[model samples]
Target: MKFGRRQFIGTTVGAAAALSAPAVLGQARPRVVVIGGGAGGATAARYVAKDSKGAIDVTLIEPTRRYYTCFFSNLYIGGFHEMAALGHGYGKLASDYGVNVLHDYAIGVDRGAKTVALAGGGSVPYDRLILSPGIDFKEGSVPGWDLTSQNAMPHAYKGGTQAELLKAQVEAMPEGGVFCMVAPPNPYRCPPGPYERVSMVAHVLKARNPTAKILIVDPKPKFSKQALFEEGWQDHYAGMVDRIGPDFGGDVVEVRPDSMEVVIDGTVEKVDVCNVIPAMKAGHIAALAGVTDEAGWAPVVPASMQSRMDENIHVLGDAAQQGDMPKSGFAANSQAKVCAMAVRAALTGSKVFPAKFSNTCWSLIETDDGVKVGATYKPTEEKIAKVDGFISQTGEAAGLRKRTYEESIGWYAGITADMFG
Candidate 1:
């Protein structure tokens, strides 16, 4: 029946803990753990830390300290940019933004315990967890191809060393050798990525190995910016590139990495280099977290980017099954901003604002020839719905195309700065 002054303070703080953190109590700050350090995860971690201003403890978990962005990596393969340019480090995020950067892979998520198990023999607790683990290749999606065959037949889809490998293989092709690309199916990362990479490879082959041939076996009948890419191939790299759509047996394909062969609809074709971009799903860790659906993508509340399965967990970027937005770096970054704001509001009693998302995917067809597709989005009752859109016209002026290319370069620089710093 005796309530001391210390007991009164404890009860008050406990009652207000859910609403706001006590600045004078010396209690531990709220913890936010983010997995993956690319477009979405890095941006989320940076924004939450920078915006929170030390009100929350933010930790970013990534296996690589220097993240090689999947976006703009094609430019490296095309010789427009260097591999070093695509790589971004987390030093600034740690120093300037006060984010705890951990170079460790997330092996498991103990959701009930609100902790994540790392491969490096430790577990970290989190008040909020953000999963932005980009993408993972779906096994058996392309027969005869897996990570084991990556060295002989590179996918080069996730950026970094794979891109280097693919470029080297393309440059090493003997005169008039065939360079084959097995493009992935729908709902893959960067819908335009495979096509842009093909264009870059064609660009490389034209300059170094003029007589070399390029081939693309695409499961889909049409792809992102298909018309513009076709026009550029005809106008610039004419008589060099050939594509086989589903109607031409592209839908059913296999590969033999040892012999460098592609089998399309039971027709075996020998090739010099094989770049197999297989079907993709959310990175494996999302499933490990028990946040992903049967379709291999994590479903999120379109407004907040929070996991549908767990309110304390959020998913972003390529891992999220938000509607309409393409699986692209731009989309992921945009979603990250929205997610960050919602998270700050939820955890820190910050101002809550309306969520608006936008995405633009730019592709370089040839030198200074750029095409882009973009749309603005808003949250609806069911999903993130598109509001307005834009695309590069097939016959845009040369000057305009050059400007688009310049714009994409600026975007790359800007986004890297935004994410890393």
Candidate 2:
């Protein structure tokens, strides 16, 4: 009845507070769903769940129960590392971090509804989504090659079973038989991967059949760590490995898996083994989400890894078109951490830190002959630009090379733990 200035203010404030109770008390837990749980997706999911301390609901969608890393898989082929060492699992992420691990493929994405359709039938809704689907091939990049023929001339780029197949094929080659590799072009998953694989193939052949030859048909005029790899090749596997560059018809090639023949500029040659790594693009799920650009890579804001096409979804690892960073497991792991921080901040009003990234890729040339290239990166307004870099020198001391190899062994252990644990 007596509503003075103070009474009027108190009555209005009470009414406003009453109206806002449900909004405050009935808020849903923020959900983050991650697809392709390899280096990027797994790391992102784990970090968001672990650091959030049950505040955020994290779900990891991966078709496979066991995840085999592409990194260091070459060592398995070369007999330096074991296949078991390359394999990882999701038990820790699920049990320790409380992550909901779904062993199902992400078939489609409804960005408008913020839900992801799974091969297992139901759709998973999320407040935010992380996609790190890695690399997929552009069909017909190599003539007469397609998914159906992959078993004949295995790419072995995806690790696990493919790596095993390539290894078995290499070991079974006849004495003095030829092994041919058709390398991928620039901006592929790993710049040094094809060359490193060549080194591994030579390692196997040199020990088993000393007269066997390994041929590399490369499109790029030069490759990652060219000087160092050349020196190592000549010193250890001399007269065993021959790399054909673009000038000598390396870039133009066709393969006949039926006959095990490689035609370089119309010069057909028979081979006992063929490893064809076709040109790569973002995985199919990224395109299904409608986040990828014309180049088939999802474009992102370097600072946050948020897709330019859809802010609610973030792209990491090989799928994102972030500049200057190679599509290595190390690079993807780094990007995942940066993305995790940004996503948590957006959801929980946490303090966001400045984005920084780094990557080091180690390639084994021979036993105890290891080389590496890496750089630190910072996000700019335009892209993620390199800050500083390092590389092993040519003719480095034997002790130093051994030490570099040891460092790689330690790194593989550390990164795996960081991803799964």
Residue lDDT tens for model 1, 1-421: 1123343223222211222233335768889999999999998999888877788899999999789998988999999998988888999999999999999999999999999999999899999999999999899999999899999998898879999998899899999999999999989999999989989999999999999999999999899999999999999999999999999999999899888889999999999999999889999999999999888999999999999999999999999999999999988888888888888878877776678888789999999998899888999978999999999998999999988888787777767777888
Clashing pairs in 1: none
Residue 227, candidate 2: C-alpha displacement in angstroms: 0.5
Angstrom error of the Cα, residue 371, model 1: value is 1.1
* lDDT per residue (tens digit) for residues 36-112 in model 2: 99999998998888777777889999999999999999999999999998999999999999999999999999999
lDDT of each: 0.88, 0.88
Candidate 2 has which clashing residue pairs, if any?
none
What TM-score does candidate 2 reach? Answer: 0.94
Candidate 1: what lDDT? 0.88
RMSD of each: 9.4, 11.5
Off by over 4 Å in 2: 1-26
Q: What's the CA RMSD of model 2 in angstroms?
A: 11.5
